[model samples]
Target: MASFLALLPRSLTTFLYAVAALLRFYGNIDTTPISKIPLTILQWSFITFILGTAALLANLGLEWNAGNRSRNREIEERNRADQERQRAVSRARIQNRFFLLQTRHQLTPSPETRTALADFLSFLQEYGE
Candidate 1:
């Protein structure tokens, strides 16, 4: 109710102005040549056509803006999801490397492989895995 009342002043002002405009438009017309009802109808139709065009353009602008903003947000979300997937792959790679090093150490036991295992272990610890 409060919100409805807030619009009352502007609505009343617009209605009174429209009425005054219509009276002034019809006043100078020589109704002796044309009937009053048809002349009134034509003016009303013209006003409504102009208003409709304005509303259509306004809605089109709103829709275009919404689509552009939505596309940007969608791209951002796709990039964030792609980053998360890459992080998961990195963690898995670290785990797989640790597993392979352990299995090889149990088999051949080469010193070079031992050094590689130490380096790999350090990498794994720093990898946030």
Candidate 2:
């Protein structure tokens, strides 16, 4: 399919030449151009309309892509901020739990409370790193 598409232009050109030759054989086909043919108003208007439409579509596509990029960046930033807030909340909860355990241990000393405090400190050390 790719090779066929690549050869399409050459094939069309050869076909046009064959057609021109056949036409020339049937009549006295003048090859010389007497003057440059000026385009009619409608033809010029059609060309200008096509060019303007193409430019407008191209500009719209560019703007759409730019808007999508900015929107994606904003969404990513929002996601990152949400994740940070969650982490901060988790850290605060852990600290509050640790403080509560420490206060209980200070009021009434217990082996279980000491072990739990030690475990919490170890977890904080590992997580902070």
Candidate 3:
């Protein structure tokens, strides 16, 4: 069986492996003429090698998938943190503008500055909410 699989194209190897797996599960190799119930140590080793190769590839694929998922999650977390920082900085800028306008109005006592302060206070109230 191994020799037959080796003779086949590499592209067909995966399909053959699938077929081999189905046969292993349901075909009952013990009943087949090719299979001996009391398998020799060499025969057992060959079977183990065949199945182990498939298992190793499956394990590697699962690990690779897990790595990608973790990396993507980390990137998303970093992006969220950056956006939060940007929002905090924006709020600080708004607060600074409000304070500066209020101080200017207090010192000058002018109509324009008073109106500007009023408008900024309203903006601050709306944005802070």
RMSD (Cα, Å) of model 3: 11.4
Please give the distance, in angstroms, between residue 54's alpha carbon in candidate 3 and its true position after superposition.
0.8
Clashing pairs in 3: none
Highest TM-score, which number?
2
Please rank every candidate by TM-score, starting with the best. Answer: 2, 3, 1
Give the least accurate 10-residue stretch of model 3, judged by summed lDDT.
5-14
lDDT per residue, candidate 3, 1-129, as tens digits? 965543344434455466556555654434333455766434444565586566656656766876999999999999999999999999999999999997866769788878878999999999968
The parts of candidate 1 lying over 4 Å away from their true place are 1-41, 105-129
Please give, for residues 7-74, the per-residue lDDT of candidate 1 as tens digits: 55445545545655675577566333235455554455465556555555655666687699999999
Assess candidate 3 and give its lDDT.
0.68
Per-residue lDDT of candidate 2, residues 23-95 (tens digit): 4453344434324756543444444455555555655666687699999999999999999999999999999
How much is the lDDT of residue 94 in candidate 3?
100
Q: Which stretches of candidate 2 lie over 4 Å from their true place?
A: 1-38, 110-129
lDDT of 1 at 59: 53
**TM-score of candidate 1 to 2 decimals:** 0.45
